[model samples]
Target: MNHYRQIAPRSKEAGGQLFAQFEGDDTIIVEATPPKWCDRRNRYNFHPSRWLQQQEIRKRYSCGLHFVGDWHTHPEAAPQPSQEDYRNMQDCFNKSIHDLNRFIMIIVGYAEAPEGLHVTLIGQNSVQLMFCENNL
Candidate 1:
């Protein structure tokens, strides 16, 4: 079974701050997209154009790195995956030709103090909390 790297609170904050990061050596590439959402509740947009731009920049910056998976924010306490989120992940997984290890989905919740923000990973059928880290 594959296990996810548990991201620490400080790393989660860093992930939130940078919002995105791409790192790789040769055989494998890792890229993470932090959650970015609109202010409106009903309209949940993940900013695809920005994500595309980030991919392009990564291609230019790193010779081997490529787009892998994405992340988004939920803006709720005790966040739970919504129907739309599930659908989107399904679409993403279906359209992807790479193996499961190459994909990742992260959801961040903007709650309150102490717990402040929480990160979760969306898999094919289940969800799991995740940990993040800074490459540099």
Candidate 2:
């Protein structure tokens, strides 16, 4: 997303949780909590502040906006999840208290691209890249 891109050109990765709400069967992302206090930062790695703050956000919104997924910048032409990325997603799925069956991962490539965004659906039983429609 443009928010990620604005910080991608620099020397480190930028990331945060994606906030959204469900409408019937659809999940519509409406907001995000930018990285506040990242514990680690580098071109290839990022470890954001743990999920503690996420709880505050959920309460602030009265649990209306859920932590649907995460978004980060990748310094490459194509965004691909690293082994660590997969691990993180798995951790998220296991400890999720919202009873989420699926979590999303949005990777934004560094290169200028017509479509720099790549989204993946990481469910309890499957990990798959999802087709996106440009309704944005």
Error of 2 at 56 (Å): 4.4
The Cα local distance difference test for each model comes to 0.43, 0.73
Task: Give each prediction's root-mean-square deviation over alpha carbons.
Answer: 9.6, 3.5
lDDT digits (tens) for residues 17-89 of candidate 2: 8888889988899976666664477777778877655664567469678777888877776666787887788
- Candidate 2 clashing pairs, residues 3+ apart or interchain: none
Question: Largest TM-score belongs to which candidate?
Answer: 2
For residues 5-115, write the lDDT of model 1, one tens digit per residue.
123332222122122333344323244533335212223344345455455545644654444555555444434456776677666656655444434555555544224
- Error at 33, model 1, angstroms: 4.4
Q: How many backbone clashes does candidate 2 have?
A: 0
Model 1 lowest lDDT segment of ten: 1-10
Models 1 onward score TM values of: 0.47, 0.81
Residue-level error in angstroms, candidate 2, position 58: 2.9
